[model samples]
Target: MSYIPPHKRQLKDPVSPSPFPDSLATKVMKNTDFKSSSVKVNIAYSRDAIFKWFLIGSKGISDEVPPSIKLVPVSSDSSDSRYGEKSFVLMNTNVEKENVIAEESEEEERTRWMLIAEKVEKDLVVAYEQAKKGMQDHHLSDNAKLRLVARFGKILFRRIHAGPVTEYWQAKSSNRTFCTDVPTSFIQNIKSKAIPSHEFCIDLEKEVYVVQISHYTRPHSTIICKCTVKEDGSLSMYKAELNPLRHLVVDVSCIDKNLDMRFMLAGKRKMFTLTEKERSNIQRMLDSVTVDSTVKGGLTWPHGKPPSENGYTIFEVCHVRATTYKNKTLRLRVRETNGYSERFGTWEVERGVTLILQDINTKLQEQNIERGCVLEMLRDALGTIWDFLHCDASLT
Candidate 1:
């Protein structure tokens, strides 16, 4: 073999045939063609598979979008148009559903509030009716009435303590005394000044002098006297009589600020005395009275003209034994009308008295009497021994 330099070795052409045996070369060409065809078939199959997969993925994306969004066509001019339409439809659908649900909830809430309001109104009406009924049926209790009787006694004591002034003049001489030393002018004046009555002065032309007298303690009783007045100015009594409707008798005494009063209603045949319990109750009520500057003696009814619905006045002082009291002793026997027609039960009197006390205490809470000063004064004036007789004069 001829030796050649390494840099001068000849390069073979790419298109030249192989320098191998024909049979081996043919086998090589066959293997090369088979490999080339296999590669081309694989590439064509991969491209078609990828295109089908892309189409399927696109269809899946369209299915995921809501039908309302899918109906909106994609605009070629604006890339964001399709996305904007889809979002608007989705948002609108969600918002509409939320609005409907909210409206239903709001309607339910309004109905609930109305029901609550109606219930409250009904309760208020019922409560108001009950309160009205209670007020209408209200009445005083037995204890209250007893207190009222005590209050009445205290009022009488007050009047007696203040010196009960009488309205009529008592006859100093005999019941049928005659005036013989009367002047003719005096006779004429007396006849003119005197009120003529059918019973006393039947003939006014006659020179007659008549005097009618009524006592405060015995208002229903009258003393009438008729006298013949001569022109010579002499008055002579011709007739005299006592007209009485009913008799009144009373006995009262005071000792150390305590009153022992007894009364006898002759016409009614009822005799009663103030028990120790009654006196103590009266004292308590008197002490509870408040002092009022507008009233005389700092003690008076806080509410004027106490309610008489119960058929009796609480603090009414009708008769006072003023003239009978002498040297701390009083005795009285007179005729008067029976003002109290109906009999009072113990309960009624107590209820009335309690009501009066409540009214006074409600307005002012202050003690009026100190150590029974007013009562003591009354006791000192009325004396330890007293007697009174009177008719039923309870103001109904």
Candidate 2:
């Protein structure tokens, strides 16, 4: 009768099998309206095992890997570097000016940050230790939640945290990592597709849609995945198929207090909802200044009022634009936008949209498009995203 089972039986180690009346597999059949009862009993305990074995403190959890991996949302913490690395450059500039007064060259200060990679390595080593504590302690592997944490770890591991590890982990790009032991049999039916890096983590509270398409190597064909988190804590996968002929386009938007901003196509995922404080900070950002989508997708946008005089204001911070595909493998992109399509004051955004439209149509005219080749492209995108942002830790 109770949604949760009695705690007495499961209290042995707080992670032992619960004396529940209905197993998760049984409940899943009942809840999903499936007719089969011949399901795994471990489903009921998979979430628990993940929590106890991989998510809590390291004191009372097993270090061994569990059968099921949970995906928990690692919400952005109250703490994040405000200015990112750009702030350091500005500080160095000021310091260099003072150093010049005292007798140091600007080049010296510029080169000073080159060593930051070494320090970041120290931080990464420390972070990995701290990150594993939650997993080693709790064993919570839902796969439908806590994805951000896993990816945060990846970004740290591959990029900012320590620069780059030895080729034992990866080669060439900071976005790639090679795992030698994974067997294809365990992950059968998995195929490659392309998806957009835009609108990543969209509607995190309700869904996790990504775009996908069949894989193509020559940079003409790309695909993406679109996944949603179901009410039962399961994931529904989707994909975005690229029209190599259709020319997938991406546009990043942000403002510059310094006016000198640069961002590579580092990586992206579907945009999810933020915590209360993040929402607040985002609101403040919307109020204070104007942020523009550098890519001319020709978006009409509505600007919000500044918090300088008025109270807090709400704003639309996400958007989507998936391409129509002839294949089942989809090319999806969930772009995070600050109401670019609605914020245009008097400037016409159609011009920008036309540009992208032209690119797609132009490619089509060039006869450079193909279909049903998403496996490799999708694999690469998945690999890129997974290596850069995914970890078995999403099983939180």
Candidate 3:
């Protein structure tokens, strides 16, 4: 008998109609172990219909293989030259786990960034929806709605570009345009929360002349006490009181060589820079006023005290002794040390002082006392008294 390999074995006078060799039955039963005979069949120059059917049959058989078997692609140029013909490479069962884990981590990072971008876009859509509903509830007409929406779109554009990632925020405040056409949804990928919000006064008015020390402009203080003359032949004193002095800009244009100063006061959702003449007058008023060194906070006694031969005097109350007087009206001892010695004069703060202090506390809270500069705190303290009373006010 002639010798024959197990895979090439054939039978004559077959008992079954099926043409599949007997060895193929054993190969299919133990699917984990594949033989060369299973893959070495002639596939070149096959008919189109036959090749299609062959692929369909192969797919069904491949399902029996383990899922962990990776089908990595082989370089076509290298494989064709080295192996005559090759397409995919079967990854080794014992391949390192670290490489697979690293690849999985990289894919996860890409997915996370995509998710963040999608979330920002969704938030922008929700904001617009809310605005639309609000306008509808207000019974805005169709034309009004269109105009408001157009304006709101501009606000949204500035808001989106205000993010830390974009360079648009670096533009000067005045130069910023309200007619921008950028859409909020386009900023989906930006980290908007990183931008800082600038703070300014709420009720700040312009052309209000007040005094401030010229630390940079001049060695001496100048008080700007210009008054606005009314049509009724009455004079209205320029009031810079109640303005947050932290955002105040003095002499930005550098116009005055001696003591040029400017005040950046707030308006409705905006700010107004004072004129050069207005700033100069305010600086003169600030320079004229003098306070004692012992006082952490003080202001001129505005209600009852008259201006003396020296200047407008500043006073501060000792809160510890405010209610010591048995009378319903308390004689609160106040320190009068503007120009005189610490105990040179005795000033009284009555029930009116209580009201004044209450108002001061409120204004201080609004200005955020902890973060206030010395000049700003002094401005608020002096302003609280200045606006409350109008006696012997002569910083001019």
Top-TM-score candidate index: 2
Clashes of 2: 100
C-alpha TM-scores of all predictions: 0.14, 0.21, 0.14
Q: Summarize candidate 3's per-residue lDDT along 172-279 as a digit string, tens digits.
A: 220111111112221111112101111111222222212221222322222222334345422244533211111111111100010111111111111123456655
How high is the CA lDDT of each candidate model?
Answer: 0.21, 0.22, 0.22
How does candidate 2 score on lDDT?
0.22
What's the CA RMSD for each of the models?
59.4, 24.3, 39.2
How many backbone clashes can be found in candidate 1?
A: 22
lDDT tens digits, residue span 1-396, model 1? 232211121111011011111222233333322121111111111111100000001011111223222111112331111111110001112335334434554334333322322222222223223323332354312111111001101101001111111100011110100011112232232223321210123211222333332334433333343444334433343553343111111222111111112221111111023345633433333333343324332223335432221121222211111111011122111111111101111101010000011221121112332323432332322221111101101111
Worst 10-residue lDDT window for candidate 3 reads 49-58
Task: Supply the global lDDT for candidate 3.
Answer: 0.22
Tell me how far the alpha carbon of residue 123 in candidate 2 is from the true structure, in angstroms, after superposition: 2.5
lDDT of candidate 2 over 185-233, digit per residue (tens): 2111111222223222222222233322221222322233344434543
Pick by lDDT: which candidate is best? 3
